[model samples]
Target chain A: MSTAVWNGAGRRIHIQEVGPRDGLQMEKAFVPTAQKIAMVNALSAAGLAKVEVTAFVSPTAIPALADAESVLRGIERRPGTVMTCLVPNVKGAQRAMGAGADELNLVMSVSETHNLCNLRMLRSQSFAGLQEVIAVAQQGQAAVNVSLSCSFGCPMEGDVPEQVVLDWSQRFIALGVQGITLCDTTGMAHPAQVHALVRAFKARWPQTPLTLHFHDTRAMALANVLAAIDAGADRFDASVGGLGGCPYAPGASGNACTEELVHALQLMGYDTGVDLAALTQVAAGLPAQIGHDIPSAIVKAGPVHQLHPAPASLEEIRSRAHERLQATANGL
Target chain B: MSTAVWNGAGRRIHIQEVGPRDGLQMEKAFVPTAQKIAMVNALSAAGLAKVEVTAFVSPTAIPALADAESVLRGIERRPGTVMTCLVPNVKGAQRAMGAGADELNLVMSVSETHNLCNLRMLRSQSFAGLQEVIAVAQQGQAAVNVSLSCSFGCPMEGDVPEQVVLDWSQRFIALGVQGITLCDTTGMAHPAQVHALVRAFKARWPQTPLTLHFHDTRAMALANVLAAIDAGADRFDASVGGLGGCPYAPGASGNACTEELVHALQLMGYDTGVDLAALTQVAAGLPAQIGHDIPSAIVKAGPVHQLHPAPASLEEIRSRAHERLQATANGL
Candidate 1:
């Protein structure tokens, strides 16, 4: 049984924690700035190389991230931890830069319908805004990453063509963007689509860094991630507890749960440098915080090899037997 | 934006629902035979091509399956549904035959350690038992299928070699086993492993039918399925609502959720002849039935393309906004 270790691309898989930004944004309750800060601090302590701290969109647009600055200001700065904030436009970019964000992520939906529905802007306008955001971030000396939302498939437009994503990606990279994250906003990406898109993107921009943000709404996120990884994508965006849904893209679930993703990568002998047990513990705390049970498989079932204590006594065994009986009785 | 219709072997992907046998045996609860019948009936209503109805195991060994005969007799058979049962030995095979099971499935753990721990018998003893079971089933004119458990990996002895699975498969086929299921007992198989194993298994056993039974313990179940499909293995075993865990393996989750698997296959343009929305409705009833939430991704979040009703009233929009605020306030 020889184990193969993946040490490609000068680094192992980079899991960018998106709980604070992508996760909290879709929830119904307002996470206090301090709690958001604490979540970020906890995620950083959990050995996440990059944390998407918050999005710097207007408060009216997304009230969940209204206190982005305070959250960024409150978290303890760990060396080598890259803190990022999402910027919808140049104005958001300026706000994130002023808040001392290490990285600025400018997002523009690849599909015209999604672009209009999500950002309330035309595709051309969003691209223009992205160009402006990239210029401003560069001027501020902050690393700029561009996310092509609905790059795989769109809820409104249905199937998004690869050439569209590729054309937009080249445009973004030409504007001095540092990285590209192909966002499966509505979870419409299948494995083949992910592989083809990532392979094409990588070939066109070999030097540019690529990340994949996948949702588990269709249970294809991990498969898509594998396809992306096989296509040379090293970085990915995931939520801690599979929190977050697309408000615009109806019925879409949360991003790929970070703990489960890490567990899969680690078991595959990919060096994620994430403590699976610790991440599982942190994920356990999320349901209470979110006021709802999370969609994460690892959080509810625990890790792949996690062992429950053997039935200590005959009574315990009998009780387990009884419970099993009830489960079977109920026809499950 | 082209969709590939999966017609590798036939028009539809054959789904063999294994919850009744593989799933129920792992639970501690002794589900009543009548309830097991109801669950099988439900699965049939959900359009499954086949269902593994029960396991005829010893009362002393797997107490949960003590009433296997009663369970097998109780199911309300549906048209075109093939009811199968697991038979561990010649005695079990005889019991299954007497119970009027449509098919008799012989399970042999591929790894010697697993074979011992699971069956308390050596590899040769298990093979001998399989031969006896096959002979008995053949004499009864019942179809015999062999499931090679721990074919991908084992708990006691990690990473069962590919050759071991191939050798066991060859032996089982030679013993007149008509069908084979390669099971990832411990969820330790990767896509590459699945691809290699399925390709090799098919190359050697071109005439023998192959089915893939996978567990999502490490979140690689679906990926492995896709790899196997790409490698030309069409038939798969899935549980409704992703119900079931290994009785012997600690911390193992259920089989690949049927709804999620069907959704993936359909989205990839593979005709599964399954209505995902209808399955989702059936899956929603399982949590209450099982007394715990199943680790199915699609059940909680719905499919990726399922659209939610947008807030129609200003008050509703305000309520959504307020909920988001509360989520943020709660520090989620």
Candidate 2:
């Protein structure tokens, strides 16, 4: 496989669907609780490794996900698919565990400025709060995954030192978080930067389940993903239909489209363990479901395996060309 | 330097701007001839290695480029830029050379179905006709480049064997063509296939200047480019503002956006020789000129280096947080 050429793993890539939470949280119109449940169920049934179900943050903070409890209660859990929920504080963490979330996804920005703007707290305070949340999760049945936003580059800080990310990750790992997701919150990640950071991260914590979350704000998401893979990172966080945009970067695009990544990886001979056809069918309906057009290339242009019929007039053009050649040959 | 991880060249990558020819050819509205000339001039000035100025096809066949001669005459010939024009036949080749074109980009499809549908001729006829065109170009000051469409995979016929593309390329090289372009005309290419084909082509014809032309129809163009580079292919064909689409595949996007590729490459530590800022300035104006928004990511969301300002309420939020911390410390 060409992936071998880049020094990436040939093993099956793990895909975690984050559309239900990361994606829908950015939607202006509230995706009804029923639709959110249905979306999560569909994604889980499609055999994703994990599906971030919803955020357990306060309704006043993220009104879009105000129905977090209703959605958690409504979903039918599928075996082998972990249902995770975003937890902003110990309160949200307890709420998520009470509602039976399989994993608690704790997020804090690696950039102090971004942490303040995004979480309304300093990085120190956010870390302290997440420590409490992790402590709470340790008392429960759910696993904990810490998502470090602005792990690549901060919109405000420009570049977050690699050591900063490592230190925060190390701190979280000390608390026994099961996973760490490095997020390009506003899509400032480039391929080289991703490869370097991922390599450094892996070298330090090889056994930790690391997920590389990318946004296609500048159209470098998939390329970054490829670079991350080459650096020995396999897990990815993608949203359906390329849902979710950055509130900070006005014109930036959303998370890397789930189907786009799966389609490309499958073609590159990487077993993504994804049913692309099933995923695309669900992705194709997202435009109407979200009341907007999507940025998913696979949904817009069918998979490469899906053949487009020869131009409708192929035979007609062939016959016409034959007649013209005949006339020219006859010297008419 | 992470491009080092991919075993690709650290040398400056060549950028060929094809928006004027391959891109404008698909537009429904007739972009005014003057605008076309200005766009070409701007692209040439932006340090592109080659600019596909226009096509010399029959006006009846491509009315959008009816003013090809005028555009060729009007564009300021930048000293370092090669002004290439698409030549479909012996007549077009003659016209392009006569109009001061620096290079003639001759084209045919490796896939017989695509050849028949697109050129209304069989692969044999295309090869024979291109041979004649090559003979004509040999008599002129212009260099000849053969662009093999569907070299990756045909939308109608599916996979075109890598051997077929190489065989055609070998034939063109035998005809003394200065360049050979492997075109993924409908964007069916994936990373593995591109890497394999490019490796084969480079190994077989080490000296020939091979350009990889990819459409973003399926959004794998950049990834394919990265793979090609890893396989020792350097030259790429990209359109500004992603200004073209496949007629056969509905909803398919255009050629890989030039600025997007340049931005990604620049960030990956490879020099593309083109000025991204200058190129993006011209690309930003394309939407107004074309009467539609484009898919160029850098143009839409400014380049990664173009930092967005921090949100306006940071200090206020910081002050509030500090005040709350003081209140809490005081046991209020």
Candidate 3:
């Protein structure tokens, strides 16, 4: 049947795997530096376009990723995969560049309340810090990107004004940022919101690439991704095996899963260019690495086309069915 | 902000709570008959337009639901609620009618492989059995609805042809079935497929009502629901607390959760006419009832608009920010 879903017109969506950084940072126990490096190396080899290696924030603040420099130094970076790292301030930016991060991603929240709570800095202070970081990155000849956390909504501040987000994007765009990633920090984004915001953001900055970071705390990440795709936004930040948990919501799921996201995109005629089979092997190995089960649906359910055979009782049931028919005929 | 999602023009979606029947059937432990009845009562009272109370399948087949007769007899049917129960054969139809079922739901799998395995009857035999059940229901003046299982795809047979589903729907419509529920038996239903099938179904049979039942095995149930909604299908079958599990996909999640579905639809401004607050409480008490935690996103993450206050550090953060700014100014 010629339908919309099966029409595999050669459309492509870019994926940035952030599990090593975003997912690993949320773990209570520190992942070994070697394991972290291996995970990042496996992810890069899996055909992912970008890998957020680790954050250069204060090691004391997030000791789980304290070995960011060592891990960055160890990983084998593939040619097409751009190795990115999060830098919260100019110092982090300097360290990230020294560690050889191809793209320096700076983090700030759109909501003043969230910025204050998350970074202990005023919104303007974080923005100004980003300017300094961007300047440092420019000096080092490193590409700079800005990650606008809680661009959707703040866990504490409720609904963020769209104008607040647009204004910050405009300001960041003026600072020569190469890419802007709007994050749903607590899975607060709805499809319509994603659709409207992505459309609005793309309309404002056609040249600068846009990315969406979604949490599956509310199980709407894929739905939100679809909405973003329909709005013509291509890039997304996903974690392999759906690793990570929300600090705000206890036991809340983390990002839109990388393999799951890729699986859906590939099925729907949009090419993600990531090897789902190899990517799943990476996800399959994550539980042993992290010592916990991941919440990725594809991992649990298998791919949509994976067939499960009929239960083995079919042989017995055939005879039983014949007996039942005979008995029914006799009873009638 | 007159955006697409904000413009809610009062489109209504009808939810059929199948937790008491479909969800519980998969449970290993037997929930008390009183508990089953109370659960059904609570669901019907929560403004769900339809509640599938219980199945009249043979007790020998499913001992967990052996008290189906007691449950069906004990539940209080509220006005504006259609109490439906599964009637597998003419005997089930008679029993369900005797217990005062408003709608007798006859089930058969669209896939021959599934029908034979699940029902121990060939596809033609299942169709003949449905004819007998429909005839019995007609004599009792009870409404008949057909549940076409594996209409999306079967685990045993991969990629059930869309034409197969369409032909079955045509036959069921010809048999005067008032409503037909297409079930994603193994979570094979994707959004685009759901959209195409829903659009095609509605176009062919405008008068016959259609309902969509989906499992969240691959976590696309809600996304598929949104796609179905966009394609003009309004009815959905959901289980409370995301109860139930697929026999096919071990450890896979169950149906689209009732409260989570209601939460998203309500946030999107679609009127479900079901009280989300009351529904969530019902879902909250389900882990105790079923002896396990459900994977319902709303149960875990709360509603989209439920605000998580900023950590109790507004005063401290403001002072800390002031000190950081003062230190920066002194350096400046």
Which lDDT tens digits does candidate 2 get at residues B1-332? Answer: 24463432357899999999888888888989899998998998899999999999999999999999999998898888999999988899888888899999998999988989888987877887888888888987679988999998998889888889889888889889899999999899988888889888888889999999999888888888988888888899999988888886666678999999998888887878889999999889988887888888887778777777877899998988778777767989
Expressed as tens digits, the lDDT of each residue in B1-332 for candidate 1 is 12222222234788888877777676666777777778788788778878998888778888887888888887788877789998877888888889888898888788765665566556676676578778888899999888888888776556678888888888877777779999987676766678778888888887788999998866778877777776777799998887887654444456888888988877666777666777777677766655666666677666656654422443444455456556757988
Evaluated with TM-score, which candidate comes out highest? 2
CAPRI band of model 3?
medium
Candidate 3 lDDT by residue in tens digits, B256-317:
89998888777777889999988988899988988988888888888878887767779899
Candidate order (lDDT) = 2, 3, 1
lDDT of 1 by residue, A1-332 (tens): 11122222234888989888888988878987877887888888778879999998889878988998888888899886799998887788888888889999888888866665566556776786677778888899999988889887776557778998889888888888788889988777877667778778888788998899998776788878876777778899999988887655344456888998887777566778777777777788887777887766676556546544423353444455456556656988
DockQ, all candidates in order? 0.17, 0.58, 0.54
Query: Which 10-residue window of candidate 1 chain B scores lowest in summed lDDT?
Result: B1-10
Compared with the true structure, all predictions reach lDDT values of 0.77, 0.87, 0.86
**Chain B, candidate 3: TM?**
0.95
**Shift of residue A296 alpha carbon in model 1, Å:** 3.5
lDDT by residue (tens digit), candidate 2, A194-279: 88899899999999999999999988888889888888898999998899998766665789999999988888778777789889
The TM-score of predicted model 3 comes to 0.96
Docking level of model 1: incorrect
